[model samples]
Target: AQSVTQLDSHVSVSEGTPVLLRCNYSSSYSPSLFWYVQHPNKGLQLLLKYTSAATLVKGINGFEAEFKKSETSFHLTKPSAHMSDAAEYFCVVSLLTGTASKLTFGTGTRLQVTL
Candidate 1:
């Protein structure tokens, strides 16, 4: 068991619109938080990560996330949604439990972009 929850199973946004995806987490130790974007059959690309080095982390393609320890949340956002942005987004947490580093994933949030 690790910390991290994506509140929405799916979200829809029109092209050129803003996009928001929610995520919450719980961890016993400091965690390495990450938001990964997967495009159709492609491998996950790291959108951003928090490693206790920063509170607010910015990622590629106009995506960003803020780490709020008080709220136990790390939400991802984008200023505008592109037609190619339609894909599966995963909110994940990396933890070192025992001797291995593990990646725990939320159920996942699907982004539907429409023109």
Candidate 2:
């Protein structure tokens, strides 16, 4: 079985400050991890993905995450927070069955950017 957990349900950051969103994951087989962001009434957008290629993965909008096998973590981070970044983020784990992949999503972390 595969599972993912968002360490924080809500993360509040000040504009122009650093942003960090913690996540942990577990899988029986080699897992593919992804971070997705969703703005208000907007469809989920693919931020970044780690598929055993690189430990550090960079995504759109200045977001990035590092895959740490030792700690079983894939935490997302950004150099500075932007008001437009306020949205819900999901940490996802994917397992390839045969031809398709099954995805498991965390409860989600809501990012709030304040001035």
Per-residue lDDT of model 2, residues 1-115, tens digit only? 8999999999999999999999999998778999999998999999999999989999999999999999999999999999999999999999898998888999999999999
Q: Give candidate 1 regions above 4 Å deviation.
A: none
lDDT per residue as tens, model 1, 1-115? 5767899999999999899999999888778899999998899999999999889899998999999989999999999999988999999999886998799988889999998
Best by TM-score: 2
lDDT of all predictions: 0.91, 0.96
- The residue ranges of model 2 lying beyond 4 angstroms of the native Cα positions read none
Among these predicted structures, which one has the highest lDDT? 2
TM-score of each: 0.93, 0.98
